[model samples]
Target chain A: ANDDCSKMLLNRCSGCIAVRKSLNSRNISKLLHSCPHRCDHHKIIVEAEDKYKSEVRKSFICNKKILLTPRRRQLRIES
Target chain B: MFRGQRGWFCGSVGQDLRQLWVAEGGTVCDVQAADFLFSCDASHPDTLRIYQSLDYIEDNATVFHAYYLYAVANAEMKTSVALGHFILPPASVQKEIRRKVGGFIWEQDKYFQIEKHDEL
Candidate 1:
């Protein structure tokens, strides 16, 4: 379980990590705890179109890519 | 007891229910009306009553927070500043003591420390 995501593997690519608002970054550990809404390999994201029926939990599938664009609050500092 | 230029008074105790027992040096009392902007006392029935009837600092510089003691885990969850003044409970374990002034940091005696390369 790492916080910096220095060695995260996403689709054989090494860098792209799922950065969710509740998750901050994809570095899951057994004893790791941040938001109660976060769990290993799964997240509950509301589908944007229908705000009412998007209550189901959704898993995020991501790939590692060299994103040259700047991101907001991208620096994930874990507790 | 007059506070000098940049001195801060600090001391706290843990109660049976993890309540922080504050002594005289704490802010709730002894602050001159001109010392603070606002203050808040949380739901400690007996404690709040005693601190209220007493005269308090009336200026805009006064502020108090009486939160569920253990409910607040880390202050960093509430801060986004690189360098600034804030009356916070305590920064996270990952954050190092970077600076100090005017208020009491939960732990650490020295005023400031930088983060990124720090340890608890």
Candidate 2:
């Protein structure tokens, strides 16, 4: 939604995209430690973790200045 | 057969696939002088000495996989672009050019065109 904070926002700062990796790892660990009597929660945890990671990666790339640099092969010729 | 003093054999296919084809040689001459060209079958060796010489020439020459056929001589001269060579599949395999797999089809060429471009 438009309400989502843009990482590269010039005036209103949200957070650094690079820090999401550690944030995600911390989240998964917290979820695992809080699980008391495990039932079908394993599948739910795995699905949630995958979704979180995908979102983190997508936003990280989007908020950055650029992704991949453009390049072409050099042509060498002789007479 | 090529008769010009400055000659070049080029493989027009992609660099990744050019290695599979044999080299060709020949000669070209025209009153335009600049239009004069020569070519030979570089892939077919005339003699042991000539075969080695052709290989040495091709190895030393710069190869280009241009949209159109391109030629360069001695590494320092200007490169020339031309459409002299023609590569195509043979008539026998024309029917088998493309085959149906599970849900996909594949095409293969039977004939290869190998030609040399003369100095411009």
Candidate 3:
């Protein structure tokens, strides 16, 4: 998988392809390996990962139920 | 006339533009080495910065956005069809492209005006 990733990077694969491949991988350490240079493809994958993490954080925050029942009720009611 | 020019294309339109560039005798090359950089979206920060630095008349390097190319091609096609000329001369095509670029610059100024208005 690391060899495949290196080959794809060398071929200058499109951002979408790179993002898909990176997202499909179960292990980041293995996929990223020791890439010599931070090329455009790597930058795209990093950006996508950051975006995904942020989105998950946001959703978790939104779903959190605090003890402020009245405030939470009002917020839900308003929406 | 792109007889000896080196060109590079960005975005999906690059493939189409590559064919056109080759047809016009231009060689496709790496972006850094290209005399002509054609992009579908010139609004990308890096491309925008390069475009802002270019002197359209004085600089040998030129960046052509896809909108300008479409406008030029559309006008050329219409003119050729109306005149029953299957193909227009290279000199005439060059002159038309220059005129279209001038118009495109004006359109870009209008875009800036709209952006400023939105900010205000």
TM-score between candidate 1 and the true structure? 0.17
Model 2 lDDT at residue B56: 16
DockQ agreement of candidate 3 with the native complex: 0.01
lDDT of 2 by residue, A1-79 (tens): 1221121122211221111212221132333335453323233323343343344446546777334233232233222
Better of 2 and 3 by TM-score: 3
Compared with the true structure, what per-residue lDDT tens digits does model 1 show for residues A18-57?
2222211012211122334432211211111112111111
User: Which residue ranges in model 1 land beyond 4 Å of their true spot?
Assistant: A1-79, B1-57, B60-63, B68-71, B74-120
- Name the best candidate (by lDDT): 3
Best by TM-score: 3
Please give the DockQ score of every candidate, comma-separated: 0.02, 0.01, 0.01
Model 2 Cα lDDT, one tens digit per residue, B1-120: 112322222322243222221121322222112111111222322211222222112221111122212232211322221221111111222223222111000111111233443323
Worst 10 residues of 1 chain A by lDDT: A52-61
Question: Which runs in model 2 stand beyond 4 Å of their true positions?
Answer: A1-39, A65-79, B1-120
Please provide TM-scores, in order, for all candidate models, with all chains considered together: 0.17, 0.15, 0.30
Specify the CAPRI tier of model 2: incorrect
Question: Lowest summed-lDDT stretch of 10 residues in model 2 chain A?
Answer: A4-13
How many angstroms is residue B73 displaced in model 1 relative to the true structure, after the best TM-score fit?
A: 1.8
